[model samples]
Target: MNAQEILDECAALYTLPGPPKDFGERTVSDRFEPAAVPTLITNATIWTGNNNGTEVIHGGEIFLEGGLIKYVGDRVPSHFTTNNRVRSINAQLAWVTPAIVDMHSHLGVDSAPNLAGSADTNSMKALIQPWLRSLDGIDTHDESYPLSISGGIATALILPGSADAIGGQAFIIKLRDTKDRTPLSRVLEPPYSLLNGTRVDPTIPPRWRHMKHATGENPSTWYQGTRYNEARKLKLEQDAYCAKAQAHQWTGLPAQIPKNLKWEALVDVLRGRVKVNCHIYETTDFTSMVGLTNEFEFSIAAFHHAHEAYLVPETIKKVWGGVTPGVAVFATNARYKREAYRGTEFAPKILHEHGIPIAVKSDHSILDSRFLLISSKFAALRKALKGGLQGEIGQWYKAVAEGKIPLVVDVAKADHIATLLELKAEVDEYTGKSLRLTLTHATEAHLLAKQIAAAGPDVGVVLRPARQYPTVWDQKRVLPGPPLSAQSSVGVLTDANVTVAIGIEEGWQARNTRFDLAWAALEANGTLSRTEALAMGSSNLETLLGLEPQTDLVAYRGGDVFDLSSRVAAIISPARGFVDLI
Candidate 1:
């Protein structure tokens, strides 16, 4: 659509009823199809994406129809058999799990991520440019979406680039390779912020500088040599223009408006409603942004690249916000002093300990999005081994509490939940298994992660899928209670028992290619049990995402999976047949 037409459409939308006054408006119920072909997978270990839990079955068959899981157990009821055409598969080799959800992304919207030639990525014209929208520039034809689809990425929350202090809003999009397809209606609300620019304010109160520069004949000569005067001139013009613009907006009067798109965006931010996901670093910037947020009453959803998040954990805890940092990305002195750069790999762990809500994102282009699972696992391991940094995920949750930071509640060993945390352990524990064993373990891990991540902290099963792709049937929470940490650990054995004839750990390598220390967990090299390890990846990661309870369906290729890659690759759906994972 043309720019004029887009604006006209937006204007017409604004004239309609605004957001609902009730909190119920936030999440609408999902619409399910009634009649669907019945398909059955028999005799397989199942990970009910219900908790930090998995149930191993020798011969289990599940009935699926109308896009909902009718039954997931050892026996299929007879009623489902009478009316529908049943296509049964020997699932002894397959591990089925929910499709992956990428909460933070720039796919399709920013298209190509690099800044060198992309004007669509950033708006540096002003400090607080909120008007810039990534959706306005989404190249739906971009190949990134197709690449993500290969990794079983079912949905992505496409956000604006974080080139500025205030990036534009975010939109959730279904991963589709169709020609001009309509996306699902239940997208997360778009949040935005303005990128602060380097413009100085000319209206500074001059005190000591005037005294020093006062000469008998010349005035304020002390500041003459620097480019301060030029900066001040630009600042004055910007301020005057901003005043005129604000006045005009209030009165609908003619005024001098800035031709700059960046400035125009900031007006939306100041008006509130748009949530800001800032890309900030320094402590000073964080403080300033908080001040701005208070002045405008807009919520700060998160601090995108908060390398300095550790510096002001207390302040962040005050506001219900989050941080999505590149966990392993440590800065080099070549770009800036390494001392100024705070890394993110362990930040989530630290924040969790200090009470913060944490979410992990690939932040990479489409092709490599699946790698996010590995990246998050790395963070979990580093934090867990470091002793003092325990409960890092919990700290993040503390930071996101709406009221005062709650005191740390004593959680049992069974309470330790994070899907990433559990996966790291499960993948490690079953290191050198047969292709079938590996497949069963990986399948259990993926499903457990989904369940733990989908449920919130109340159940102690951490499984927060991306906010965009969370199950929304009737908008009601339908997930069952999660298994305790101990139960979750024992659950892996259930899969291993029937999947393995002798149930011996002798042949398992304890380490494999997918994850780095996963072998130790498999070999019992580490004190943590295989179940405990899986809990870290499955339940812990879920808890970190605030999705403790999950209720969703995942379909995978029928077979014994050696690693996560194979399982991720075996997706077959009508829109995308045989999802490609390279």
Candidate 2:
């Protein structure tokens, strides 16, 4: 198969043999019906999702009636408490927080156990597939759901895998269902408007190194193929279709480009109906795409895995004049991939100071859904370190080839890069920076407690457990948490009071990691406050994703030191009503 064949397949998404049918709204089809029992609670400390615990309710009692919080205060509503239909509970001096929301996960779509049939996150046949969706591939039986729920996670935005340059669409769904699955009913928000993809260079599979194995047509085509060629061709094709669509929208001419669904989705982005969520790294993709989006008129929603986003100036004066990306970053465990060599945990601090919101991502399956909360903790901590030696990107490859890291198997394999630049002895001899700042490892974010406090809320972080990489390294599943220290960064992110959230980067694989991260933060002296730790697993996660209402909560022991150290967990959810999964 060739590029023409791939284009032909895309064309099929537009037309069918018969005319379109418009069965206008009449009766709903198997519509959802949430549980009806009203729940009441008395005596607990509650966080109302107001930024930074500003509107916390002390000794609060809540009336959760009809799938929503009817009242939240020190006293429960008389009618709710008196009504025979409402159920009540005496809260055990616990802290009540909004349910955890993992914004970046591939739960059902990538269903665990590491089986081939269940792995539906990416579509390898096409480099650009906006039509693919996480919805169609979701398996309600994925055990990660129940496990994550036990950790107080109530909602997740399941997304497609980042295989091609433009993988597919994502959907935000509730993690609940009756004994019988509803037909297309579990979707809380369908077509979540994120076209997931990645720009990281090392994630490319080794088999695709040969031209014969790199074609986008099938997996067997043998033409002279390269992702560079594919990426270039895709941009041209998308520009052509989107430019025409813009003309139709602006001029009302040519009757709308023959209604191509693929082009139609791209046009939705062009017209601001959707946003692109690409797994990004390095300043090149950031700077280049900023220009690309300007030309296409489609704004990026969030740049996931933007390890080098901090290097991108907040305001860049390009050849045209200036560019404002106005984009958020779902920053993840960086400094692992090649293009992400310059990645830093302090990216959030820098990006925040530059005015960009940062969200932590587990890249589930990369970290595990269970540890999503910790990911945020670590990102904030690492970035808040007082002072540290930064890595120089221009001199990275030289250090790597000189056997500075584990990424390169053989130092002799240097055909691609000829000659190298000399680096300062301090940064290069691994004296000023950490040994972890090598090509395969991560960069350090070292700053004093006062320095981190001064960085302030300007930096927001989404962190995962430190150095927890599973199913990595040529598909080998490496699972072992790293040892913690007093100088850990997780403690510092909290000192700055940054808005933080967590993700289950590697869904089922890292489910237990969230607790591991929290434990590390709690034991680390006076760095992470108990309130901030619990908030990341709850309201902080919700706020980062712009979740609403401040309902759907979890209960935990409340006092001077609040923690997820709860041996028992209780939750309130929009779906499944009020039930403790743990």
lDDT of each candidate versus the true structure: 0.42, 0.50
| Candidate 2 wrongly placed segments (more than 4 Å) | 1-33, 179-183, 191-257, 313-332, 372-582
**Highest-scoring model, lDDT:** 2
lDDT of 1 by residue, 291-389 (tens): 544543434656644666766777765443233212212211112434245554556777767766665555546336744443444454434332224
Candidate 1 vs. true structure, TM-score: 0.42
Number of colliding residue pairs in model 1: 89
Error of 2 at 309 (Å): 0.7
Q: Pick the candidate with the highest TM-score.
A: 2
Model 2 C-alpha lDDT per residue in residues 1-582, reported as the tens digit of each score: 233333443343232222114313322223235555677888888888887547788788988764566778888758666768777787764668888777677888778777888888778876666666777788877877777776667777676776565566676677777545841456653321222332122222211000001112222222232122434344456556545453433343332223555545554454344545656555655566566655544456566666666776552223122333433344445555576677655567777677665666555666676654433443332322212224574245334323343121111111110111112222234433322111111112222224323433322334443433433322122223224345344555454554544445466845564575566455546566666666766676554443453676665554223334454456778755766756
Per-model TM-score versus the true fold: 0.42, 0.49
Residue 76, model 2: Cα distance from true site in angstroms: 2.6
lDDT of 1 at 100: 71
Worst 10 residues of 1 by lDDT: 207-216
- lDDT of residue 417 for candidate 2: 9
